[model samples]
Target: MQIPEYQLFVHPSDRNELRKNIWQDDPITAKLTIGKKKYAIDLAYRGSHIRDLRKKSYRVTFSKPSMFRGAKEVHWNAEFKDPSLLRNKLSFDFFEEIGCLSPKARFISLKMNGKNEGLYLELESVDEYFLGNRKLPNGAIFYAVDGDANFSLMSDLDNKVKESLLVGYEKKYGSEQDEVHLQELIFMINTLPQEQFETEIVKYINVEQYLRWLAGVVFTQNFDGFVHNYALYRNGETGLFEMIPWDYDATWGRDVDGEIMEEDYLRIQGFNTLTARILAIKTFRTHYKNLLEDILTNKFTVDYLKPKIQELHDLIRPYMQQDPYVKENLNVFDHEPAFICTYIEARGNYIRSQLDVLE
Candidate 1:
């Protein structure tokens, strides 16, 4: 299959500026050409460890932050560390199937100054545009950028009282009032009495959505997802927060460095203070237990995912053969479908065994 091509034309000075600003998120002016159309844009190198890779990732924003096919910005991830190159997209698709808000993604080919950058997964940015497209009411979005976003009163790293309730979240949309609302929710999660917390927590959060997201994380076993790889959105209409998944490349039987991770590495309860509180309530725990069982019986099984895995793997095989970073490890990439299938079978059985713990 032929993937869409994006041509980036960065002036020499802008290219130098972008290269020098490796860790900075500052974007430099550029021109992007896509299918006979040209758009002025601000482009920046994205990701932490990925910035050091030969095949790098990028964040592209329209110059005016205007919509381009329902997206104001796009994340072009090299997905270099993932041998399958399908984990991120697969995880996103899985979340959507299990009834959670997730970013949409597709494969693309990129060229910078006429240099081939090979295959990339183009991910949609979760912002105002994202909500508008879904016809959902406008909401505030905060990205959980670090371990401090574990919804706890104490710091995960230092184990000390947090200086503020909103330590690790980056406010991407909405005003200071929205930030205050988030702080209030986090405070309630940590402070309220058990019965009051169980009854009132639903007022501050969309509990069903949270449980669905929790189940997705539990199934995929995205180690970073519980704390730092999600978006907290405060719904304008409901006056409650909802969950969205992000940055899921390090999942599906692999660790961050692409090493093998056992299927049962993560637990069904998942980690984080908010999840613990939600599960502490008998009703919520029963709902979550049912959600996990339903998903395990239907969605997370090897039979259900094997064809999907093969389809994605086969679709990317041609591109994988030409990817600049995988000349020697092509075999590893080719075998990833079977590897993922094995993982699904093992992971499903593991979760099935652990479901009663939710009782």
Candidate 2:
């Protein structure tokens, strides 16, 4: 699951041909493929010859013009410390069904160097609103590469930013100077009352469904849902925001210390922080309870997850038996649901306290 020692990108003109070859019955080595037959899919920034083609998608992402190449390249050193690539893919697929995630994205298999190159979850192109904030083009297409939690937070934050601009709000103090403003944006969105952004989000672009999606994620014990592993979008006409999840390497059963404690779950849910992302107990309960029950009691109940979970169990079993990292983290599977359920119960209790505070 770690990045390779080197990474490089296929020329833009060569990408289409590379895609075709990858989709074909057989694919040759990465070198034999040309711009037309097989373009490279590198994760390096401009001018870096080493194409890491790491075990994950960041290899394609860091090469983009948006972020600094140095910082991106530095992360490669830590790539190999990650879990098996197959594990990450299965985890993502499981949540895709568990959360009933968007059907627009899909996990596709590719071949390289005459061997299975693993799976890539390709998402449809999305327009970038942040670039517009810097006066970039309006409808430019950008490929998403990030994690699910981060993606969800981006959708919510972008909505708030668009709304603020629409309402004629002036630039806030020090907004531009903040180096980690993107991280702060998550805090802003999480603190909003359920009624504030929740309804607007639903009306703008199926926010209700997204809330249900988030609830499902909580149930799955995903604690690494940060802002990096996601993509952001705004409606071309309505300008409402939307999100898609990405970079699911640290999810499923990979918790530190191999325990999915209630504290850990709340921390992931944006609690125990001196920030605004914390939700009132009632707000959290009203949204997640009904959503969890709806999905659990309905035909889309936990039963739908059985096959996928079993698939994951089977797929990773061999690796788990061999991988020392996975072996050390094995207890994570046993504690995941208990952590989720306990966290959900705590949120229920907090909802009443939040109501009391309101009174």
Candidate 3:
């Protein structure tokens, strides 16, 4: 089936206002239509650099969650840095294939004021609704909005607060004002002795599930995800934290700025404070190694992923050609999929070789 279309209409004055405050979180009213259904939405410019770009990313919050596609909030990613326009979609697909809670994504054509904005990746917001969709219990979800929330108990570079190490995380679910639970988790991670870390960590986190999510991040080579670009949720039933991957446009052998990354760009150890501690435990390290091996053998190899990449590339090729933002350079769109295939093969090999030396 062809990708769906989004028609957004904003009054000239409101649009101008949004344009003026694109760097800020100010949202303006807009009318959004999909198929024959219409919605009233508060549209705000999203992302850091992309907000200043011609084809901008946006955060669309519907008046009600059920208003459109049963989602209260959604993001339209410009994918400006990624020429292939497949990094986020492919990365999330891999995460789902490996059984992680990642946001659902759709490739859609976005038009504003009847002008073609470009091909955008529509993503589901990770909120209570997302947890419900996964049949997961509603709990606290925090977004690592800045670089400092790298799961470390140490104060941020700015030295925010020692007691509340939740400096960079923005609470998306549960009580925004409460930092006690989050701080406790951090305290355990930082202060717990190495001998008791494994036992204590599992009490506050789904250890195996977290290892799987960590594997996804490492395999995808998403450097940003180790510290930022993830949502941490406390499961209501288990009272343990789990990770949800987000903003994967910087993955699959690409750095956050979309530059080509080295095949071994991320080390298996010392990526972050939490991960370093986890890997320090022999049993946990062995478990993580086994997971990595399983993925490389079964799912992450070129033989398994090449066809999938080809299928997605073929499906989106025509739309990529029509996208005005992508018109500046056609070569990258055409060749990047092949580059990805090569990257997958090389990355898998590199990880396999480095596993023994990681400790």
Candidate 4:
């Protein structure tokens, strides 16, 4: 493969190591320049080997960040070696089939040193939000990339977010609060009049968009659809929370039982007919209704979604031919029918009870 020849600034030690081929475990390092900026560069490993390199490095996504003096634009060039590259690309593209509502990185194919590489993604840095004429870096407002890190204009997870999310329950909610998981938080918010409660929940995942997200989650078997992965950006202007999904490295039917059949995907996510009813009767009705609505009606529900699920089956079907990982697991994508049946029935009944409210 022809290399893209991305401009770079190389560290002397890294350049020396590459020249000597001494860095076996993590070889291929360089400082790459893009436009007028330079970024730190490092070799990323995915799967086993680069498309051409005989050596195998899997576990990291390699990239060189543009590093230039007083450079404001940040650019990175690197090899796509992350184990989850395919799924990440699919997730970004999935938004295209569904009306994309969140920020996504653009992917481009590149080559280096006769090795085939993939350009993963690039994102514009988002600075602190401006409030009125002043900049507010000290509010309960915070943004988290993943579950592990939190980016805040403020100091900590003080009362700001707690106040917004845990309204009316602050005295009982805190770091010491254990009962309020994301589900319960949604339940609590549902308790308020739709107009009042929506004021807060809308800041994260609105009623319509959330339904689509739920459908994606159910279809993809994305169990980690908690608050951390999908976050709420409080638009200070609209005072509405917008839901955005991120960090989708665990889907694509990788962890499902092949013999289980695809019809039960929703059941696995706790939306099956039997479990759905048991949970609804035991839990809040409105909450379950909201959750089911978002999943069943999202645009992706029909667009690339069904086709994507079918593609997953196609990808696994070939692998099952010989790969030991899926050799005995052939029925990985059969849960679709069962989930559709169960969700429709369960959600239909729930909606009937709310005809007055919905209309």
How does each model score on TM-score?
A: 0.97, 0.45, 0.96, 0.43
**Which whole-number lDDT from 0 to 100 does residue 260 have in model 4?**
24
Winner on TM-score (1 vs 2): 1
Flag regions of model 3 displaced more than 4 Å: 64-66, 156-163, 176-178
lDDT of 3 by residue, 1-359 (tens): 69998999999999988877778897998898989888889999889867777789999999833446667899999898887889999999999999788899989998899998879999999998888877888789999987778778665566555555777799898884336788788878888998889788899778888889999998998877877889998988888898999999988887767789988888766377788888888899999898888999999998899888888888888788888888766787888888998899899989999889644
Model 4 agreement with the true structure over 12-119: per-residue lDDT tens digits: 666466546433546455545445665555543332124334322222223433322222222231222222233444554654355434434333333343343333
Q: What would the TM-score be for candidate 3 when compared with the true structure?
A: 0.96
* Per-residue alpha-carbon lDDT of candidate 1 for residues 130-225, written as tens digits (9 for 90 to 100): 899899999899999899999999999899999999899999999999999999999999999996987899899999999999999988999889
Model 2, position 76, has a per-residue lDDT of 20
**Model 3 CA lDDT for position 230:** 92
Which predicted model would earn the best TM-score? 1
Q: Please, what's the RMSD in Å of model 3?
A: 1.7
Runs off by more than 4 Å, candidate 2: 1-87, 98-206, 256-264, 267-285, 298-303, 312-359
lDDT of candidate 2 over 121-237, digit per residue (tens): 433222242433334334222223222233233233344333221121112112232213333433445455655753433333435444544544454444544333344333344
Give the lDDT of residue 41 in candidate 2.
28
